[model samples]
Target: MKLHLASAVSRLFSKILRLHYSFFSGKILSVRAICTDAENRIYLVRHSYTPGWHLPGGGVDNGVSVEEALAAELREEGNLQILGKPMLKYVYLNVEGSRREHIVLFTAQVSQPDGFSRNFEIIEGRFFSMAELPPDLDPACQRRIQEWVIGEFGAAAW
Candidate 1:
């Protein structure tokens, strides 16, 4: 089991390195939000291109603020409206993916719009209770939830 886990980790790093070389260069900034409703249900989205469910977010444009990027991503990906000031949770240095890549994560209480339909970029967005999270949830998102919501902060590479 340990061997399998190590092999999987190795392959993941290999892929990350390949991606970095092919697509990414210089410093990269991105934003992700942990959007929860009054019922404490977490909202997550599955992208058409990506394989797993994750926090709704995208890259921060060259001149855009992180807050603006977060808001835009929440609205576009999950139909989420921020109810209050989003609290900064953590800034993770995604060194494995790209040495200069950083992910700015925030926690926000959000409200979903009346009707949310799938679009080209996002295939699905749903609020899932803690006990009912999707099996294919992104590992990075899981780590954020554990650290921010469950207060299980650990030494982890995000």
Candidate 2:
């Protein structure tokens, strides 16, 4: 019941954001990192203010590159110290209607041991096997992972 309520509220907030940004002049760009450990487990996070498990990432700040934004987000949200470079995975057009939003997905490997704690933005995080992912993961996140697995390459999503 709690998860359901949270999911409903999250969806409502996202709709509101889209509607609010519809009248804006600029587009919204965000980044997500499919972080993995040496054991090949995927890092997933649950936001304090949002429902569902999602890739650890956030918006790209002004004047900051997407890679930099993703790194900052990983550190802030997951205490993730990226070992090396992040590989580009997929770039998707997040939503239609009001907001012209785009999401750049990247796959990153972390070098350090996991020790993430609850923060203001993120309340929970854990690493899970690809086949054992939480059932409540975001659908878009699942699709992105699927695309990566199949080695599909093409134009950005619409």
Candidate 1 versus truth, CA RMSD in Å, comes to 7.4
Cα lDDT of candidate 2 equals: 0.80
Tens-place lDDT digits, model 2, residues 1-158:
77657666766776777677676648888899888999989899988666689888988878999999998999888788888899987677866433377888889998545598776557788888988999999877787777767867444662
Query: Per-residue lDDT tens digits of candidate 1, residues 35-147?
Result: 89989999999765557999888889888999999999988997889997998877888856656778888899999867467776676899999999999999888888888
Q: Rate the local accuracy (lDDT) of all candidates.
A: 0.82, 0.80
Candidate 1 pairs with clashing backbones: none
Specify the poorest-scoring 10-residue window by lDDT in model 1: 149-158
lDDT of model 1 at residue 31?
94
- Models 1 onward score TM values of 0.80, 0.81
